[model samples]
Target: MHPSFTQRVTALEGLRARTRQATAEFYQKPGVMPPPLAPLIIVRSSGNNTFSLINRATGEVIAERFGHNNATSHARELEADIKRFNVKQFGRHLRDWALRISAILFLFAFFGSHA
Candidate 1:
């Protein structure tokens, strides 16, 4: 029989992929205003209590929004920034976020030993 852990990992990946796809589709839909894509790295600074985004490819820092820790506000800011960023750059940033999130999930699944 297939290992139970293997099944769990697969399920996790599927969930992540679906979520990522939905987010992307939302930005790409017609008549939907897209955000700027200057920040390659979107960080929720625990200490600063602000949302920060960094564009590593261009070494540029776009606008930082406060009180955008929630999903709706974060998405709005991202959509705004996405318009300012190059299409190619936006693609790269999206891929980077996806990879980073996937790695985080992998670590939690593989290393978090249960009692």
Candidate 2:
């Protein structure tokens, strides 16, 4: 029999903790380096009629809805929420890029004048 979603997620969370510990140990070893950890996104859909958006890092339930009848409306709301989140994330990235570019330009203007 297939494991339930909650059970699978619980197992994965245990593995994630172990991986994090191993990563910490690897960093402590002499001259050992690994690539940065990538973000994790887990998506699941079931006919059981429940919806949830969770933040894996913080273990927070950002949003959730229950009931089969409201599924369509819930899905639409979730889609809009995702769109808003994406736009906010995009804005943050743009702001960060602008800051980096400004810093580089400032450095060039400051150092170039001295050279």
Give all candidates' CA lDDT scores: 0.70, 0.69
lDDT of 1 by residue, 3-115 (tens): 99899999999999999999989989889987754545555443455665545566455556566555336655666666677989889999999999999998898888652
Error of 2 at 109 (Å): 0.7
Off by over 4 Å in 2: 1-85
Q: How close is candidate 1 to the true structure, as a TM-score?
A: 0.31
Candidate 2, run of 10 with poorest lDDT: 38-47
Candidate 2, residues 1-115: lDDT per residue as tens digits?
4569889999999999999999889889989887855433223344467766555566665556566445446555655665575877989999999999999999999999999
User: Which window of ten consecutive residues has the lowest lDDT sum in model 1?
Assistant: 38-47
**Best TM-score goes to which candidate?**
2
C-alpha TM-score for every candidate: 0.31, 0.32
